[model samples]
Target: MKAAAIFGPGDVRVMDIEKPEPGPGELLVEVKACGLCSSELGMWVDPNFKTDDPIFFGHEVSGNVVAAGAGVSKFAVGDRVTIFTDRGGYAEFVTVPEDWAIKLADHVPYDWALGEPIGCAMNGTSRSGIEVGDTVVLIGIGFMGGLIQQGARLKGASRIIAVDTRPESFELAQKLGADHVIDAREGNAIQRILELTGGEGADVVIEATGKQGALDMATEAVRIRGRLVIFGYHQGGKRTIDVQAWNWKGLDVINAHERDPQAYLKGIRTGMKLLEAGQLDIAPLLSHYFELKDINHAFLLAKSKPDGFLKAVITF
Candidate 1:
């Protein structure tokens, strides 16, 4: 089978490799689609990210079960499923534990079945403790932030404020149910939110942009004693935070990334419910697609994020 492997920064190549088999309580899935995250962009370029040459990557996946190992009973060979953490989703085939694959809804398309991120967003929403009349501020209107906006709106957030530098993001955020949009590049994002919230700041502030500056802005934008949710993938590198402000404000800071499989599965189910119930629509977010052979190009596009590039995915 042919699989795309990352040799190093900006050097990805497709190679003919032996397909992996399912071990006990695992399933061999023929991947149909996979989504790329921003973290991969850093991995593709940053030399400090030590790894074996041509590392197996791409965790966001949706596929059909081709083979099941011993002790696998919940799924069969023909089940159409979206994988949570099945390894090497960039390839044509990936082997994951039986519990990692969730059966997809009949109406869900294969491409849109990349549900791990969605589940993570759902988990963020749940951990956020967003109330019916809460004023929510989400900094960085990317894919995860947009979905969180939808989730906040669905939860009856009185005001959903979106902040992004891109003009297109404002339009998309409004369409996704944000009540207010702030151009981060225009001026002080913290000031605008403070003004919008009448100097009290928001009830819940989420930093979905992993950038340190954005995180600083979120800390300033959150109200005293309000919850601040960190929903972005801050994979590596250490950064400083304003410990004095945190101590003074009495802010409830929460790291909303879900590491447990059971937590992810629960969020996946909730995300599926939102999709089925019409509360969350991901059609607009999937802005680019590429074939397996064009995997390197896809990564480039995702990294550069040219105009109108909301997200990209690889299709089998």
Candidate 2:
């Protein structure tokens, strides 16, 4: 089997590795598409984050089951599914625990069936406590933020304000049901959000950029007693928060990232259900594709994030 491993910063090479077999209660999947996640960018771009040993890093995987191990009765050899794996997904073959696999509808596209991040979006929006007629403000309209916007709309938010620095993100944000899109580069994002909400600020504010600037704006964008959802994967350093404001506002702050495997499994199942029911559309979000051999190029493009780059998928 062929797989990708990072030798160092900006160096990901495809090399031959022995194909993995399904262990007890596992399923061996022939990889079809694996997503390039933003969380892995640290290892790909920064030398300080590199490790002594590098294993396969891609984890958002969707493919066909080629072999089923003992005690794996939930899936068969030919079932099309998306799986959750600790690692080793950037390969021709990878094994998945039976409980971590979710069946995908035949209509779902392989490239768009990225279960992990979609599951993260589901968990994030669910944790936001969005209700009907609530005003929701989303900071950072990237891939995770965009998915959260759609989920917020589906959850019956009356008004959705999308904020981002990139001009290219505005169109797609509106297309995904944002009532208003604010360019953070203008230095008036908080003011615009306040004006739109009649000075009360939003009922729910989600910070998905993982940058300190976005986090500061999110703290100010929510209503006095509103919910503040942190959905971003903040990496590389420490973050400071306004403890005094949080104390005064009585905000219900939620760190929306899930750690438990069962929680992720539940979210993944819900996301897949939404996709199958046509309530969620991920096709527009999967904007780039590359083969396994070009994984380095894919990582560079993902890091630089050129125009129209929502997400990158490595296809077999």
Candidate 3:
């Protein structure tokens, strides 16, 4: 078996390694596809972030089950599955608890089956308490942000506003069901959102940029008594927020991370159902694909953000 291991910043190498066997109640999956997330880039660039011994850098994974350990009953050998977790996926094989391995439907494509980020976005959006007929503002139009926009539309948001510095991202957001797109770099985003919402700030504001400025903007763009959901993984140190603004508006802040596995499972089921019903199309979101041997090239392409680069996948 071959796996990409991270030792330190700018130090990732693919090396032959012993295949992992399933422990009790675990299953071994022969990975077919894995998606590179932004958090993985942060971990790759930051020297302070520590990983598990012999770190394998991936979470969104889809594959087929080759073997199952004792006490596993829900699935059998040769079943197609997806594994969602914090790490240990950028390899030919990954061993996980049976509970974390979700069986995929026959109609689901192997590449698209690795749609774990959609589930995360769903969980975060649901927790933000988006209401029907409410004006919603989503900052950032990356992978997670795009999915959040789709989820907000599905939730019946009256107006969906998307903010991003990149013109391509804003365009993609519109295609993903955003009613309005704002180029934050071009002008005052907060004022534009307020103007569009009829002088009353957005009913729900979500910050998905993971940048300090975006966080501050979210705090300012939300309406009085509105909910603000922070779904981005902020790699930088402490961020400053205007205490006076939040205090005066009586706003509710919610910090969402991938913690609820059950919630994620439910979201995955919903996403699959939507895909099967042709109500949601994620195929357009996939930007690039690379073979397992070209892992370093894949990382470089993701960093470069070439045209049509939204989500990059490494296929087996």
Candidate 4:
């Protein structure tokens, strides 16, 4: 088997590695597709964040089960599945616990089945307690941001405003069901959001950029008593926040990550059902595809963010 290992910053290599066998209550899956995530970029550039261990990267993955270990009864050999490996998904084969292996229905395409980010967005959005008829604003139109926009729409947001610096991303957000799109590079993004929400701040503001500026803006863009959900991965760091403003507005801050098993399961079931029913369309979000051999190119493209590049998948 071949796998890509990240030893440290600016260090990644493809090498022959032994295929892992399923352990108790685990399933051995032959990976079919995996999407590159933006968080990997941080891991590549930061030395302190670097890992000495040869970590097999990738979490959003879809594949087929080749074998199951003892105590695995929900699935059998040859069952198509998607997994949130958390790590070790960038390999030809990944051994994952049965609990994380989600069996895909026959109708879902393997390409779209690898949409674990959707589950992440779902978990975060649910945590925000976005109610129908609320005005929602999402800052950032990356993969998670796009999914957040769609999820907000599905949750019955009366007005969905998507904020991003890229024009292409703003347009993509509109296509993804955002009622309004704002280019944050322009001046007065917060003012524009307020105007869109008719003078009142948004009922819910989701910060998906993980940038310090975006975090500050999220806090400023929400209405009094509104909720602010930080959905993106912010590599452990400290950021200054206006505690007085947060206290004055009585705002609720929620930090979301894909850690809860029950939430992951519920999100997968809901997202899969939406995809199967054609209520949610992610085809436009997939910008490029690459073979596993061209994994390096895939990483480069993800880093470049070239025109029309939203999500890139390495397929087997």
Tell me, by lDDT, which candidate is best: 2
Looking at candidate 2, the ten consecutive residues that score lowest on lDDT are 47-56
Clashing pairs in 3: none
> Deviation in angstroms for 136 in model 1?
0.3
Per-residue lDDT tens digits of candidate 1, residues 137-204?
99888788888888887877999999999876888898887888999998888888999999999999
Question: Each candidate: what lDDT?
Answer: 0.86, 0.90, 0.83, 0.83
Which of the two, 2 or 3, has more lDDT? 2
Tens digits of per-residue lDDT for model 3, 1-316: 9988887666667889999999899999999999988777876677686655667778889899999999999989999987776547889998988888778888878788765787787778778789899899999988788778888888889999999998779778978878889999877998999899888899999999889989899988999999888988887688888889998999898987766777777777677666666666677778899887787777777777887788889889
Q: For candidate 2, write residues 1-316 as lDDT tens digits.
A: 8999887889888988889889999999998999999998888888765655666778899999999999998999899999998867899998999899999999998887899999989998999999999999998887888889989998899999999988668977988878899999899999999999999899999999998998899999999999999988899899999989988999999999999989998899999999999999787788889999999999999999998888899999
Please count the clashing residue pairs in each candidate, in the order shown.
Answer: 0, 0, 0, 0
Better of 1 and 4 by TM-score: 1
lDDT at position 121, candidate 3: 79
Q: Is 1 or 3 the stronger prediction by lDDT?
A: 1
Candidate 4 backbone collisions, by pair: none
lDDT of prediction 4: 0.83
- Model 3: residues with Cα > 4 Å off, grouped in runs: 47-53, 260-263
TM-score of 2: 0.98
Overall local distance difference test of candidate 3: 0.83
* lDDT tens digits by residue: candidate 4, 1-316: 9888878766777779899989999999999988887778777666676676787888888999999999998989999988877657778999999888788888888888865777777777778789999999999987778777888888888988888898778878978878888888887899998887777799999999888999899988999999988886876588888889999999998887766677887787777778878876778888899876777777777777888889988788
Instruction: Name the TM-score of candidate 1.
Output: 0.94
- How many residue-pair clashes does candidate 1 contain? 0
